[model samples]
Target chain A: MKKYVKKAFIDTLPIMAGYIVLGIGFGVVLKSAGYGLGWALAMSVFIFAGSMQYAMVGLLTGGASFLTIAITTFLVNARHLFYGMSMIEKYKDAGARKPYLIFALSDETYSLVCNSDEGRDYYLLVSMFDQIYWIIGSVIGSLLGAIIPFNTEGIDFSLTALFIVVYTDQWLNTKNHVSAIIGIVASVVCLVLCGSDKFLIPAMISIMVLLFVMKKFCIKEEE
Target chain B: MNWYAVIAIAISALVTVSLRAVPFVAFRGNKQLPAFVDYLGKTLPYAIMGMLVIFCLKSTSFALTRGWAPQLIAGALVVVTYVWKKSTILSIVAGTACYMVLIQIVFR
Candidate 1:
C-alpha cells in the first residue's frame, strides 16, 4: 500500500505543478467575479472538471440559462466519452473503488493511468492525490487572490499552452494524420461559422462525423 | 449561492459524470464494444487534443488592431521548442512565460 501510494505520488508530480497553477487561475477568476472561497471549494470538489470549471466562471458571470450551461458542459466534456471508452477494460475489475475512479477521471489523470503499468490500487491513489492537489491549490489561490495585487490579464492562457504542448507531443508521436487534420479543419470551420461562443458543440459533432466517414471510406480504399 | 448558480453546477456535474460513466455502464457483463467504437477510442484522443488547441485560441482575433501577434509568436515558439526538445514541462512553461511576458510587458 505504501509503495503504491508513493509511486502514484511520484507519477503525479508533473500534474501537481500544472494543476496548482491552473487551479490558482480558476480560483483567482472566481474571486474576481465576486465568488469566495466556499464557492471555489464546492466547485472543485463537486464539479471537479478543470476545463468546465473555467468555462463555468464565464457562464456564472454571464448569468446563462440552465439549459445553456448543461449543453455547454456536455460539449466541453464530450471528450471524456472517449476517455471512458478507452479505460473500460482496465477499470472493469477495479472492485469497489471503480465508482470513484470513474468520477475522478480528469484528462491528466486519464493520460497518466492510460500510459502507466501500475495496478488498480496505484491508479486510485493517483486519482485521489491529483484531486487533493487541485482542491488545495484552489483554496490557496482564492486566499491569495484576496491579498495579492499582481497582474493576471492573460494568465488563463496557461490552459491553452498546456493543450498546445499536448497536441504537439501527440502529433509527433502518431503516424496517422487523418484524425488530427480532421480535428483542426472541423474546429476551424465551426469557429468561423458558429463563432467562439457557439463553436464547441458544432466542432465536436463535426469531428465525430468526419472521423466516422474517413474511417469508412479511407480505410476501405487502403484495403 | 443563487438558484441559477446551484442549478448550473448540478447540471454540469451530472452531465460530466454521465459522460465519464457511459462506457463503464454500457460495457458491463462481458459485453463487447463494436469495432467502430473501439476505433474511435483509439483515434479520438489525437483529434480531441487538436480540437482543444483550436478551442484555446478561440479568443484570439485575427484582426490587426486586436493584436494577436504575441499569442501567435509565443505559440510558434512553444511548437518549435516541443518539437526540438520533446519536454512537456519545459515547453509548457516556456510558452506560458513567453505569453505572460508578452501580454504584460511587450504587448501592453
Candidate 2:
C-alpha cells in the first residue's frame, strides 16, 4: 500500500503542474461566466475532463437541453470509446474498483495509468491521486476566482496550452510519427472539407480508419 | 445556485465518477489483458491527443487561415522539439514561447 501510494504521488508530479494552470483557467472562466466558485468546484470535481469541462460552461450557459449536453459530451468524449476499449482486458476483474478507474480515465490519468509499469491496483491508485490533483487545483482555483477582482482575460487558453503539451509529449515518446501525422492531416482535411460543426466526429473516424489501415498494411510491411 | 443546476451538476459528476470507477472494479484480479485490448491501449493515447489538438485549434478565436497560422506552426514546432528531446517541460515552454513571439511579431 505504501509503495502504491508512492507510485501514485510520483506519477502525479507533472500532472499537478498541468492541473494548477488548467484548473485556474477553468475557475477564471466559470467566474467570468457568473457561476461563482461553487460551480467551478462542482465542475472540477465531477466533470473532470479538462477540455470538455471548459466547453461545458458554454453548454450550460447557452441553456442547452440535457439531451443536447449529453450528446455533446458523448461526441466530445467519444475518443473515450477507444480509451475504454483499450482498458477492457486489463480491467476485466478489478471487482468493486473497476468502475471508478474507468471514470477517472481523463487525458492525464489515462496517460499515466495506461503507461504504468506498476501493478494494476497501483495504476488505479495513481489515477486516483492524479484526480485528487485536479480536484485540489479546481477547488483552489474556484476559491481564488471568487476572491480575485480582475477580469481573467485570456485565461481559458490554458486548455490550448495543455493540448499542445499532450500532443508534443505523445510525438516525443512514440517510435514513429505515423499516427500523429495521420491525425493532423486527417483533422486539417476534415476541418477544411466538413467545417467546424461537422468536423470532429468525421476527423476522428477518418483518422481512426487511416491509422487502422496503415497499421495493417504499411507498418506491418516495414516490421 | 439554482436547485436544478446543482442537481444537474451532481448527476453529471455521478455519471462521470461511475465511468472512472468501472476499471477498478472490473479488473480486480486480472494480470494480463487480451491481444486486441492491448493494441488499443497503444493507440488510444495518440487518438486522444489528436482529438484534443483538433479541438483546440478549431475553438480558438483565431480565423483558421490567418490568425491561427502561427499557432499551427508553433504547435508543429513543439511536436518536433518533443520528438527530438523527449522533454515535456522543454517542449511546452518552447511551444508557448514560439506562439507568444509569433503573436507579438506577426499577428500583432
Q: Tell me the DockQ of each model, to 2 decimals.
A: 0.63, 0.37
Tens digits of per-residue lDDT, candidate 1, B1-108, equal: 477877788899999999999988887785677787667766777677778788878888876623688789889988999899987667767887888888888877
CAPRI level of candidate 2: acceptable
Task: Give the least accurate 10-residue stretch of model 2 chain A, judged by summed lDDT.
Answer: A150-159
List per-prediction Cα lDDT, in the order shown: 0.81, 0.66
Which residue ranges in model 1 land beyond 4 Å of their true spot?
A1-14, A32-34, A54-69, A111-122, A216-223, B1-8, B65-67
Best model number under lDDT: 1
C-alpha root-mean-square deviation, candidate 2: 4.4
- Please write out the lDDT profile of model 1 over residues A1-223, one tens digit for every residue: 6889877886676678678777888898898998889889989998899989999999999999889999889888887887787787778779999999999999778766765557799889999999998998789888898554666556666666667777777767666678878888999999999998889788888988998888854243221
Candidate that scores best on DockQ: 1
**DockQ of candidate 2, scored on C-alphas against the true complex (2 decimals):** 0.37
**Which sections of candidate 2 miss by over 4 Å?**
A1-14, A92-97, A146-178, A211-215, A218-223, B14-39, B60-66, B97-107
